[model samples]
Target: MISIPKDDPAAPDAFPAAPGAPSALETPASPSEVPKETSASLQMPEGLEFYAPNYICLTVFAVIFFPPLGLAAVYFSSKTTEANQNQDWEQAYINSGWTGWLDVFAILIGLAIIYVYTLYM
Candidate 1:
């Protein structure tokens, strides 16, 4: 069993009371007294845009039709999203292209398999 010292700092009376501070419920006397937005709170402008398509939906659709290539497409789609979040437009574009191609290939291959199975049997 663990034992705490009699003078443990974690005790409620161990520390002195803090100095008086203004309560959060109090409102500023004037608008100017309110805190202003700082550069740290600012966000990037909305003008910047990325044209790459993540192909996540198509990848999910492909998963229902084909598991192997569909899973690969999902990986590429996640990479595209990660690159986009990192602001690496080039990598995002490349990953998006790979995701799109994988999605298409998975769907096509699945259809081909179904067609061949129906024809043979």
Candidate 2:
């Protein structure tokens, strides 16, 4: 992409640089283009190699609403979070998959328990 300074005379609009503000096109960020707090490098946990956790609140709710549906999701979230904190993105991604299967397993087990309880009662 052809990047042109916003204040460049050749720019279609040719606007002047804002007094203390850096025009993105005109001045490349000297050191930190993006702020450290929001940067991806800072967010990742240690030991993380590839994956990242997402939609954790939804994952937690899935567990709460269907507790019988595997608390694997709970474990997954914790592990994922830990991995992220430790900067192990890839491992966190892998752990996320386990949560879904565990939930399904929990559901099946829960059903069996209910059936046996009903039969005995």
Candidate 3:
């Protein structure tokens, strides 16, 4: 209130207080007495979290450098994302992990092919 401009007609001198506002002393003194959760505290284990991570995009870009690896990564990423959407956490986790391996394998294979071509062809 002090920081607000006094000259500004839009600003009020003081904010209006709620009628029958409960005082701190009148409020729940004990932590246990105060109801903690306004809503359900625990969620029933359900629903899919199809969150697409940025690595999927990175792996797609890898296609330009290593076609096989990039393709594999994209495949794994798609599989995992689908599983996640289906509420299949295990499959999602497994596929997501494999996507990284695919990207690495693609880079290595691309390099290997280039090396072979340069030496032999």
Candidate with top lDDT is 1
Candidate 3, residues 1-121, lDDT tens digits: the string is 3577789998888775556544546777677675544223332344423443526666865787698679879888889777766556778788888887888777777778889999998
Task: Tell me the whole-model lDDT of each prediction, alpha carbons only.
Answer: 0.79, 0.63, 0.70
Q: Candidate 3 overall Cα lDDT vs. reference?
A: 0.70
Clash pairs, model 1 backbone? none
Q: TM per model?
A: 0.61, 0.41, 0.47
lDDT of 2 by residue, 6-120 (tens): 7777777655765765667766556676433433546545434555645466555556545744466777768877776666657867776666566556556666777988999
Global CA lDDT of candidate 2, please?
0.63
Candidate 3 wrong stretches, greater than 4 Å:
1-54, 111-121
C-alpha RMSD (angstroms) for model 2 = 9.2
Instruction: List the candidate 1 regions with Cα displacement exceeding 4 Å.
Output: 1-43, 46-48
For model 2, the run of ten residues with the poorest summed lDDT: 34-43
What local lDDT score does residue 97 receive in model 3, on the 0 to 100 scale? Answer: 82
* Per-residue lDDT over 24-92 for candidate 1, one digit per residue giving the tens place of the 0 to 100 score: 677788887766664334425541376468877899988988999999999988898777666677998
Question: Residue 53: error of model 3 in Å?
Answer: 4.3
- Residue 113 alpha-carbon offset, candidate 1, angstroms: 0.5
Please count the clashing residue pairs in each candidate, in the order shown.
0, 15, 0
